[model samples]
Target: MNMSTELIGMVAGGVSTAAFLPQALRIWMTKNARDISLLTYCILGLGNVFWIIYGIEKSSLSLVFTNSFILITALVIVYMKYFIIKD
Candidate 1:
């Protein structure tokens, strides 16, 4: 609620969301995810989904928004690993 707490939350959310952007962009551009771990992404995506659910239940905007974005990225990676790479 305080300015400092809000700032920290925004920063944390921004950083966490941004962390996955490069990997998503790489997969989108290269059309390759051969080296990516399918299991890891699957687990991470599931975890992201749970976080989104928790965020919704708790009414936490930061958690919801950040985890939703992460979920999207995770799904993309999973798709690439399974479908695009084809290996």
Candidate 2:
């Protein structure tokens, strides 16, 4: 990949990855996820997992990195939805 394309990928990945930080931080701070949708996150997380596999198959670093971060964030949301809120 050219440096310009790689740079774009990194920038896009950074922005997309950052998208989950706020929600994760909110859940961490408030310890409340009652308003979050469990099924939505579950599906999103699963989708991220598939994206990771696709990234691996295609050898796309941007896809791997972005999807991996998204998957982590999605897992946190799902965990909060199922486990934390249940308590």
Candidate 3:
């Protein structure tokens, strides 16, 4: 990939990863996840795992990093929903 393309990827990845911040923060602060769909997040986290694997195979650092962050954020929400809040 060219420098411009790599930069684009990085920027896109950062934005995508940042998209989850608000929800995660809200759940953490409010300790309320009753409105969150556990199944949806589980599926999303699974998809992120597959994307991370694909990123590894393709040697795409942007994909791997972004998906990993998304996966972690999803897991955090899942944990808080299932364990912390039980909601």
Candidate 4:
């Protein structure tokens, strides 16, 4: 991978990973995940796990890092929805 390609991957990964932060933060601060779909986030977390495995197999740092962060965020939302919030 050339410098430019690697840079692009990093930038893309950063942006995508950052996209989940707001939702996680909102759920954490508000302690409400009623509006968030549990099924969707659960599926997303599963997908992220698979992606992490693939990234590891391929030795792609960007993929591994990005999916890990997203997976954590998804798990947080899932936990909040299922465990923390009653509704």
lDDT of 3 by residue, 1-87 (tens): 577776887899999999998998999899888999988998999999999999899888888899999999999888888889855
Rank all candidate structures by their TM-score, best first, as comma-separated numbers. 3, 4, 2, 1
lDDT of 3 at 14: 94
Q: Best lDDT goes to which candidate? A: 3
Query: Lowest summed-lDDT stretch of 10 residues in model 2?
Result: 78-87
Candidate 1 residue lDDT tens string, 1-87: 466765676679889889988998887788777788878888988898999898788767778888888888888778777777665
Write down the worst ten-residue block by lDDT for model 1. Answer: 1-10
Off by over 4 Å in 2: none
Is candidate 2 or 3 superior in lDDT? Answer: 3
lDDT of each: 0.82, 0.85, 0.90, 0.86
Question: How do all models score by TM-score?
Answer: 0.80, 0.85, 0.91, 0.86
The true-structure Cα RMSD of candidate 1 reads 2.0
Native-referenced Cα lDDT, model 2: 0.85
lDDT of 3: 0.90
Clash pairs detected, candidate 3 = none
Overall local distance difference test of candidate 4: 0.86
Model 4 lDDT per residue over 1-87, tens place? 567776787789899989988988898888888899878888999999999999899778888888998998888778888888786
**Residue lDDT tens for model 2, 1-87:** 677886798799999899889998988788888788778888888888998898889778898899999988888788777877664
